[model samples]
Target: MSAASEKSTGLRIVTVPVPLSGRPCEASASSLGEILALFKIGCLLKVTGNQVLAPLDGTITDIDSSQLSVKLKADNGLQLWIKVSEVSLQGHGAGCFTRVKVKDRVKAAEVLFQFNPAMLKLAGALPFARVIITNGQKIERFETTKARQCLAFEDTLFTLYV
Candidate 1:
């Protein structure tokens, strides 16, 4: 463990929310450039697993079933937007199963949704998840784990300083 892993004042820890075995990379602009441009500070995780977990303890403020996305407000007031699949898959939520609903309080590592990665691939959509800090102004800085690949609930994704 590093110094950042230790509990400290004004620091909040976020973990890998998806139970997928893949690498985390800086989010890039896709075909939906305008929409993705808003996610300047975001991470993209390659899909491998079926379940998406809560990155931190938070309440689901909004859920778009057809879009396969969830907006959560952390206990510390930080907001997050987690979206599965790319723009092409939007409104085609056939294989995606959302487990949590709006207003539901979830713990870190709680299952948020599940999807069939194979099905997404067969549909010509690259399976991935976009995790973005919606209210980034509240964060002073954040350090991402050095590891290239991370496991959900077990690996710390980012240590946020408020």
Candidate 2:
């Protein structure tokens, strides 16, 4: 199916993966221009700490060997990507800690992974973790909240309509 055709429906909600207390940074074409251009990502969430949480109820579809990146297929059919480092740092998964595996079922607010923020920083990588709709183009009706909000795990980042 086309990316746009894969959109989620039925009043699905998407959330941030980290605690809002960490001073989250939002991603955009302007703010994360280079990074987004390079990774082909449309959104991002940067936090100061290492813990990563599941942003929605979903089954793990893919996980990188380093465990720093995961792809989740939500119960509502949305595909989400959560990563510790940028695409450039994909090989550096050793600095991260992942708790789930491919095919594992997870709920929103559940702990999925953690990383050594200090180590990631030392490697010249941004500690900005991200929770994004991997198949967003296919989604037709979704509302996203403003970036830079102090959002907790399970806090609604966006609402998807069927």
Candidate 3:
């Protein structure tokens, strides 16, 4: 469905945070068990691009010391968590450059972090950006896009019914 329909249906749509040229897969408990088990449902987007963007308008709530993860709280009260790389590669010369800090307000499509995909791959990291809805329990209906491929800020990543 289109964002235009969101007003009528009382739904909120969140688009892909980063440009994805590789693939997009469902984030499951098994896949993220090592990272964050709190992510019971989310999306794992292959990191073909070096930069990660804001999925929606939100305030930077928290950022990990290793610069591998960031948490945002959208204006609509939806909480999102984004991880740059695999847990195994954290602080092992993964070379992630984070742009925002806690309490910073961000607009959709704004650059949040930059990293080297090649460097991550060479270090045996999967190079996937994990986007998790931290406050997913508050959502009544959560529908994720089936598209295996997506473009930044253009394709819908998921929709939430509150």
Residues 38-140, model 3: lDDT tens digits? 5545777766677767888989999873647788898877788877666445543677677888999999888877777887778666767777787778666
> lDDT of all the models against the reference?
0.69, 0.60, 0.69
Instruction: Determine which window of 10 residues in candidate 3 has minimal summed lDDT.
Output: 13-22
Residue 54, model 2: lDDT of 74
Off by over 4 Å in 2: 1-41, 65-67, 87-95
Note the clash tally of each candidate: 0, 5, 0
Q: What is the lDDT of residue 109 in candidate 1?
A: 80
Worst 10 residues of 1 by lDDT: 28-37
| lDDT, residue 35, model 2 | 51
Which predicted model would earn the best TM-score?
1
Root-mean-square deviation of every model? 3.7, 6.6, 3.6
Model 1, 78-133: lDDT tens digits are 78887777644544355778888899999988898877787777767676777777
